[model samples]
Target: MSTIQRPSRPCKECQRRKLRCDAQQPKCGLCQRARVPCEASPAGKRGPKRGHLDALRNRLVQLEETLQNRLDSEQHPQEHAQALHYSPGSTDASQSTDFLRGDVGYGDPLPQAFMLPGPSMAGDADTLGLGPFPFPDLAVSLPQIDRGTHAELDQLYFDRVHPSFPILHKRRYLNWSKSTAKSRSQTCLQQVMWILATLLSTQSRDLINPLYSRVKQDIDLIIMDTGPCQLELVQAWTLLTVCELMRALYGQAWASAGRMFRLLQGLRYHEIDSPRKDPVASEGMIDPIRTEEKRRVFWMAFLIDHLLSIRNRWPICTRLPISDHAFQAAQLGSSTFLSQAVTEPPSSDTCSFNECIIIATLSGRGLLRDVHGTISEAYGGSGQIHIDHDEWLNLVLATRNQALRQRNDSDRMGTFAQILGQVTEILFCKSLMTMNKNSSTESCTQEYRCRVLRAAEKIVLFAADLTALHFSMVHPFMFIPLFVTAEFLYENRALGDGAFLTQLRSLVDVFGQLTNVNDHERSYLDLLSRSCQQNIAIMPATTCVELKRIARDFLEALEDPNDPTKAQAVASADLSVTHESYPSTEGLEQFLSGWAKAKQFMPNFRMELVDMVAEVDASGSGGKVWVFSKVTGGGGGTDRDSIDMMSINGEGKVWKTKDVQRITSKH
Candidate 1:
């Protein structure tokens, strides 16, 4: 008969004494029989139970398999590593192991017998272990353990609590450990230092050392040198990017460092033209190549330091220092370097350098408006004297060309786009100021207004064309200046109102083109629209109707073929260029619809006729013409009337006793 396996019977003590007893426990009937006291013990408590035993067995089997595979690999050392696609997310164990073994493709496999040194381990090296590298200064020091002993938990109150986020202290240490490696922490520290350094340092060049040191450290962490050409190229590229970042930060600190902006460009020449003094190579090492790489990193930091100084624009002590002749000269030098970047074959080194220059230019523009009031006060009356249409065109063309032609070098091209915006803003502002000042001056003449108008028109048209051509890349930086110019032109009743409306209409029609691209053109377009609405809201209620009509008609024009040429005719031809266009029956209520609601809260709002006589009268005696609004009983009348338009003629008082001359309005 077949034997049937049944559950084990209860211990003999349970049968004889009528007490239940488990066979596997601290004590059972089997133990009692030996005169031992009985005690209960939980299952799987004393040692490895079934579950743990199974896990251990599996681990041992895996180890055995791994050992066998390793042995096979050692015997057949010539075996090639498997190449697999790497997704940023999912990774398998074999792939991970291969990565740890440095099995990444090295093209023409290195000899297996050659053993490269790794980060040091205990016993084989000193307390501060030395690597195989020759340069002691370049060697990175590991984070040190605190030397202090008997540290109380109270001392860690500050350590446990993050100053930026105190609530973080409530979480356990293990909970926050996963986030300690965040790049944001590094960025935050750098930003704090950057702001402090810019504010504290009186001399632009004085901040260079600290900036360069940080940049060098960053490069050391990111750059990996495995070969001669590849190492040199990457190092060069890193240096160039550092230079660009430094340059971007330069004009913000001090104007004096404007001269130093050229230093990075010159330094590039030094690094590239220097004699190729090859270092001695050691077996199983890339020491010689690494030395060159370090030099490249050092030079990059040096370049970045000066560039940052220039960006801060501290020396010039003016907003948008780019307008200064000296600043412009420095800009020209920067542009020269950027223009030179594209003509050469771009390696990793070349690409980064190009990027650096572009970023510097963009960053420098941020400092422009800081000096706006000073520039306006100093050169406000200079009118058409400062207009340079050709120069403006050149800057526009250069930037647009750089952005398009050097698409691969975005950092540099992006910087160029920013510089273009700055230069354009300065010109646009100067033109707007002239138009505002010349509005009422009979001596100013239509010829002068028209001349200024012509310049504004050309800039707007050029910007519009450039916007379409490189919308994906150039739009973000292009928007502010372009829209600012558009607003200014619209206020002056200049040529571009028609053109801008037309271009905008075309853009709206083909809006789909701006989508699905890497560029952030939509942000710029939105900024422009918002800005336009704000400026439009401040116009007289009568003009509101015509403005709305123009806006609506332009939007309507989008329904037509999105050809810019056709849109221009439709939008431009619709705007009434004559004085009759003013005082449209459409009131402020309709116009504000296109504007942001926050603008309605403005304390003062006025829209007056553009007059020329008032400007000449005020400007002739070194006074400023101010526009005023009057409330009429019949219809709300908004007209230009100058008040307090005289300067104190070497006197401390308001000087109201002078002859009050009234300039008649011809309109």
Candidate 2:
């Protein structure tokens, strides 16, 4: 069947070789002779052939155009607004574009998606750019450190500080540190690291003070400089806050933490991803390593804010928008990535340490959340509300269980976890104390006292144990637990036993040994020492009368001797096991006159002598008197001692008098 006569073309091979071709149907004659199958090129294809370099160049051109368009829109917003208003809204193909454009108005100037290096880029600083991060215009400049000093400081930081807080990525940081052309972000971070290392490693104020000043100046310069917040800068501020905390500069630390919180929110680190309608799908395509590091930084910021809030006794500034489940999922994903990335298996110590930190961080979040709730309930909103003790206790127990479940062989982390658990317990107990401070029922009052004493005991025991093991490893910032315990013991002198006293002395010694203890900490130590001695002195007084007498005598001794009324003899008599002679009515009258004179001179020295049996009769000649028992010891009426009182009418008034026989006579 003769098909329509077909137009013929040369085979592709013949055309490529540029040989003249005789029109053929199936194959050219040359291809047939050569025994080669031939094909013809398709018609109507007309475009420049694209190579790898050409494709890359095209992408670069496209990016440049896009950047220029963005800059132009920013520079001339009215034009952009006009364009947006004129654009068609109903086109199916334009829907995605419209949605993206909507986000452009609300999007952060420096989106978090651009914070980390891409998968192809190995280093963050290199990926960002080697130029100085633009800071606000400032006259002060950052000091530069030599490579050797930088390396030494880095090593010191990783060895001492990073072990406790592994916020920085070891491999990534090491790689960045080796770069010759460091950015301002990198310089700020290095300075903070040096400051922390020097602060922890040295007790010499002369050395650390200068280093701290230079670091602070650098931080100030960086903060004042104008640029989009970078991850490195966030990290620098985080470390700087930590350094401030180590120095017991709580106000400064809190302020720095607030700044860090703002920066983190600016970066949208508070959210797992942007809440914009047109979220970037490329975020999911980021390198797992970089994603993991970002997750770590976010959690670190979260933890720092929570811890600072707890320390400052304020509400947490940042709300955790991400759920715990999501956090756990991210943690698991990062762990999987780490496992895949490491060629050699991690040591058990390393695994345990990492697990301990992770578990502690998670549990600490829960604990801090409950603490915030308690604080809010008690002190926020309207007025003080009743703390649900059982609910708070259950929360503490749950957190403690979670922490203990993840405990490992690492002593430092394990002890720290335990200490945190005890701290939570103490906080809960303290909340109850605050709520029940003015409770009307005696049972409630007794329950509150018992709970407080128990919490105090637990705190002291946990702190003593922690101090015994790797005390030097304990951060001075952690001494809050000890401080709380000391205050409790001081207030409730009956709770301090010989063992507790000994442990308290040991804690003071540990505080002394800490290289990072600032003047605040030293002052706390001194106060704790004096409180411990005072409590120890009252330890021997078993009866309520003896306790009261000792306390009164101590207080009286502290009076200003220059005052005529306070010029009584310093009572050297041991009230623990001594009985004095009782005075006659005339002698008692003289003592009453002296007591009244003392009260007038010292407004703070009002003493109410209560009779244990019945109310003293004040009905004599238009005068009134009442007697009540005074219990100096804490807890529920365990040790009761009573002293009698008398009231005499003088100058149309009742003068309260203490019966000498009732005080000196054994009950």
User: For each candidate, what is the lDDT?
Assistant: 0.33, 0.47
Q: Write the per-residue lDDT of candidate 1 for residues 304-360, one digit (tens) a residue.
A: 443333333222211110111222122211122332442333333333333443434
Off by over 4 Å in 1: 1-311, 314-475, 494-523, 529-667
Error of 1 at 628 (Å): 46
Best by lDDT: 2
Task: Give candidate 1's error at residue 517 in angstroms.
Answer: 7.5
Model 2, 1-667: lDDT tens digits are 4534335655554553334455565666666765656677446436643353565576567667655655444565454333322123443454345434433221234332322221212333322222232222223322334466567778878777775555677666888886879877787787677777766553323446656665565565555343455678778888888888767676778777877766665555544433342335534345444544455565566556545443223222222222223333444232322222122232332343343333344345445555665667676553343346456444545544354535533344455555555555555555555556666766765665565555555555555545333323664446544665554554454333444344443444344333234442232343332334244332222222222333333334434433423323322221111123223333323444544454454454322333222221232121222234333332221333344343323221123344334332235
Backbone clashes in model 2, listed as residue pairs: 134-226, 135-225, 135-226, 136-224, 136-225, 136-226, 610-628, 618-623, 618-624, 618-625
The estimated TM-scores of all candidates read 0.26, 0.48
Candidate whose TM-score is highest: 2
Segments of candidate 2 deviating more than 4 angstroms: 1-148, 203-207, 273-284, 310-411, 437-455, 466-472, 494-667
